[model samples]
Target chain A: MKHYQAWCFDLDGTVYRGETAIPEAVRLIGQLRDSGSRIFFITNNSALTPQMQAEKLMRMGIRAAPEEIMTSSIATAGYLAGQYGRMDVTMIGEEGLREALEEAGHRIVTEGGEAVVVGIDRQISYDKLAAACLAVSAGAPFIATNGDLAFPDERGLVPGNGAFAGLIGSVTGVQPVVIGKPESHMIAEIARKQGLRKDGMILVGDNYETDIKAGLRFGIDTLHVDTGVTRKEALAGHSEQPTYSLRSLSEWEI
Target chain B: MKHYQAWCFDLDGTVYRGETAIPEAVRLIGQLRDSGSRIFFITNNSALTPQMQAEKLMRMGIRAAPEEIMTSSIATAGYLAGQYGRMDVTMIGEEGLREALEEAGHRIVTEGGEAVVVGIDRQISYDKLAAACLAVSAGAPFIATNGDLAFPDERGLVPGNGAFAGLIGSVTGVQPVVIGKPESHMIAEIARKQGLRKDGMILVGDNYETDIKAGLRFGIDTLHVDTGVTRKEALAGHSEQPTYSLRSLSEWEI
Candidate 1:
């Protein structure tokens, strides 16, 4: 199981529920760490920052250093910074967006910026939409973290970045180059960040469509665990064919 | 509830499941029909032909007439016919694609003649991909049905039409204007074919991101059921709320 130097895990359905911790998941992480495997949680959920994710992990009895978490928001900001340095960014988001950009070495500003970086702006207004469209049309590269149209939470669901991307994509005639899980950029970043080769990196998660298929997209070994949403019958019939299937992540032999 | 004269429902996750009758769903359709509401199903699943879908509906007790089902393949063929009469389309598809084009007056030949119509060529060969790419590069307008990157099945997940679009989108620098649900084109066609008016036409489906959201994209009311890839939690949090949330098609009140 530790044949790969690094192990990438997915959050939400993988490590924890929306807010609750998966005890077995925490144990598996501990096992991985004891085995000296570099652990990283590559999640597409862009709503939270890495610090928040690390804090969540700590709360769940899974010790994750701040560097151990790489979110779509961070990856997107990283990709943007790699493209252009210190560019003006018109943000339509929360603190995560601004912090990610700052961490990625880019200047974040309000209006008349060079680039429009839109995240899950829950308090989105028509005025903000109009402003974003204007920024995008004026040559601001509309950088979206992940293309998740909707995100699941305790409250139900919220329109994720993808819905906003569609609106801006329609207006700007430009689509965001997404930089999150399911895309090679995020996968590559995790691989590079942990100094682990992409070869033989096992991705463990419950969601077959996003987690398992994302592994396939990036060419990695996948072990799908039936956590929150997946059922045994559904996992049994998966044509996506994960390397291993487990009722729980703890079942895997370390 | 029957305020609109026409209603366009999507098949697959909308009306019935794979080879099974969503009986309550069928009953709802009957009620709508008895109430003088016209119904047509627009499906992007090009694996099955429109006639096949129509037959499946009848077998499932939905009793959809032959003219009531509209598949993306059929719509693609319709698109090609008006643009190029008896045009040679380099197909990356199955019998569904061929039948749709052939019935719509298109001559699917080798690599050259007029246009190259690419469909969900599951058994994608290098030769087929090359031909499709070459034809598109040679100035054929690329068209796709839906942007679904992966299709979840009983066996697992496989690349859907969105994969082909990604390939095409990667090349040619022009994204294919997808013409299926989520995109207003197919919705408009279904509405026109079913003799459904824009008003009072409610879309019932499981997937909020695609089905419910697609219905909304077309200016139609949506009824979200507890089904599809998107979970109840995800749908609940989304600010872009659907009109009605029913536990199942059975819970739908007239």
Candidate 2:
């Protein structure tokens, strides 16, 4: 029932599932944009570039600029830049993560590095994992883009970036600093980058553990929708309730 | 010192470390073989084929037949064969694992398998991992050749089969049946294959955790040599001690 200056929407379940876009979410997002609210698309998918994400949104008739997208890869890069400035990094990820690191002025190396960053790499090889383990064991700062163990594909849930990071952590006896949902790094990065106040920003998502928890930890109001991972009935299981829970975004008042 | 009918020696730290052979271990193995004791070389390495391992031992002046080597890969194949009786399996591993599975009459499929097997694969790819995850999550039995998280190479400790299996397990939320040292499966398989009794068998190794624990759990006499992972001083840390502890194999009387 409350109007927010900034509206952060989760992809996948909130806006689209696979290739299909939710009409209710699309309508709500359009209404929010028309009402002069800043729109941000936040996702834990580190494999795709912001441009690629924006293109996906565009396909669903949702207009979003590449700059408006805050992927875990971008957040990881921003977080690393803020903490250690430019770093010599060793990475295990796709083009998106590599681009983000490069854009943040970090040099990517094969073996020894100042930081070891891992993301979802579909082309992941044993050599890449071995290099990451060696670097992390050598005391380099280990950073993971996200901690998602699995994500749904056409067939079923497949291994995510967290699994790869977990493997490296298990081998090296080192826990990586996760930079995705349920940690609030992405929300904080969005707030800091846009110079937005937490009180004026709200996160809308379908996942309770990731989206709602992220918003709560970042001190922002979270609106939970039932279009994705978590259902409305599942909300009763969590002690910490979201600011608002709706069956669909169509139920929300602009 | 009591003489055993069967002498099972762990490679790597026991017989050799890297490329060089441990002189005392080589002499002791020779003496044990000449005394008509059944000689077996047990290792958790699933990447190298039995023939390759035998060749490595031969290079160190220790003659070993391919059939005498009982690697985790062979044990895993044996375990699966006994449990499921030759299944269509999906796997993430290299030559050794493939050979064992094929030799055991199990068909290796890309997806939709009755079982899923994992091992240390230097050529590991994301597609292979994803397929394994899909199969395991779809209710296929998950098996790991070994649970050694990290193994020593020239550079340092790198990710092992356990790390890779851990990745898949984390994604699928399924624990794999490990067939390696410290689990006693390899020892059990060797016993079954050679028709040897536990009372007549003695396991010799440099690592207290893997070697000694395997022998102990398998109900056999264990001799721990202070040549590799667990030092003699560190043996006091474990509440369950090895049956015999020696500074080296040279300390043992024939």
Candidate 3:
């Protein structure tokens, strides 16, 4: 066994976004694979299913098994279902939200929908907003995927999970229950399932607020890769700074 | 008869959180005092700032203003602000957001702390959270003054302006320009100076968001009555809300 035991890498910003892969990062993953290191890919984007994510990884030249990939969406589903016990969910989002709820045995309904599930729906319309507001106002427990205000795309930043949550909150006059990374339960489960303590574990990612801030609670070591969502200026004045800051993941050793 | 045609008001939820009457929301003042119509009192609190808002009729008893109160805070502050001058503003959150900006001044600064002469301070905080965050991160204009978030007694939900705007948002990011009723420029100047707007008017009182929402752009109307900080949930679903929401003052027409 290697002295450095396990390595967990964040996929979206660390490995790839859409089809683009970080030049230096590709080499690091390949080297790690060749070195026989146990790797788990984590992501905040919960839009797709794990199977799809795994496939995307392979296409990017980073070979990933389905089990190797973990997503905030997946964690969210498990958390909600485990806590509420299979509920009736009303979705104003995409497949990831629906898949998570359904997989948890929660019945999905709309227009007279009982429980509320809010997430990023780029295709969201005013009608969906109306339905969601109505459901939440009618006393359905509201759940949000994440609180990311904007998702920076190739073409500047656009509305993300937080914007959608804001709409629901504005209408129902209530904020939703968030179930993604940075929050404990999901990360705790990730640690437990991987048979590791949050401390001593290495969390590599791109974003600062969500990825890095979430790592703060676990006392885990974090390495931030630039050229992704987080800029160089954002890395200043922190009570908890990333243990290591790398231009890319190709510098990984052990 | 003058070229002035619009009336604006701001007071508690308008200018100062609870010191002076909202200057922008004093529309009925000009109508009853100076003789003008087409009244609009823009406010931030959609909950109850406008509807329950009334002019001071007597000591213990209050009187009616109108059903023309506008709440931009509830409208998300995006609507009216986009209409007039500079799109971006340094907001302290009054009359939604923009109406206050347009009514008081077109351009807003997130960095020039003292240049604008004044602005409201919501949710002020400690360390880099309040002053530094605004100056460093959001480039906010400046700190207006010590605005209270909650009021004395009432025992309900006592969230003061300092809690939401000052604490959370300042801690998170950005400082906004406040265009609400009681901001001295909007309220006091009405008495000192006149003939600048389409209408000449006067507004006063306690709350900040509502009293300031309907500043002089559309028509002058204001008066912020002391409703404590728990006034948010007071007017959640009111239809045909107030043109003037006040807590005291036996001078204005009821």
Choose the strongest candidate by lDDT. Answer: 2
Expressed as tens digits, the lDDT of each residue in B41-104 for candidate 2 is 9999888899999998999888899989999999999999999899999988889999999999
Candidate 3 per-residue lDDT, tens place, A1-254, comes to: 12334567777767886688777877776776677666787766667777888888788777788787767667767776667777777786777766766876878776766677777775655456556767776787887777775554553344567656664674456888876666644555567678886554677778787777766666677778885778756788666788777776665665
lDDT of 1 at A85: 70
State the DockQ of every prediction.
0.02, 0.90, 0.05
Every candidate's lDDT: 0.72, 0.92, 0.53
Better of 1 and 3 by DockQ: 3
Q: Candidates ranked by DockQ, best first?
A: 2, 3, 1
B1-254 in candidate 1: lDDT tens per residue?
33656666766665777777777778888888887777778788776777777777777777887677778788777766656666777776777788988897778777663666666765655445555555676677777766776554453344566656655555444577676667766676666555666675777677877787778887888878775456667786888888887667787666
Question: lDDT of model 2 at residue A136?
Answer: 91
Off by over 4 Å in 1: A235-239, B1-254
RMSD of 3: 11.5
For model 2, how does the per-residue alpha-carbon lDDT over A1-254 read when each residue is reduced to its tens digit?
78899999999899998898899998988899999999999999898899998998999888899999999999999999999899999999998899999998999998798899999999888898888989998999999999999998889999999999999999999999999998899999889988999999999999999999999999999999999889899999999999999998999998
Here the TM-score of candidate 3's chain B is: 0.35
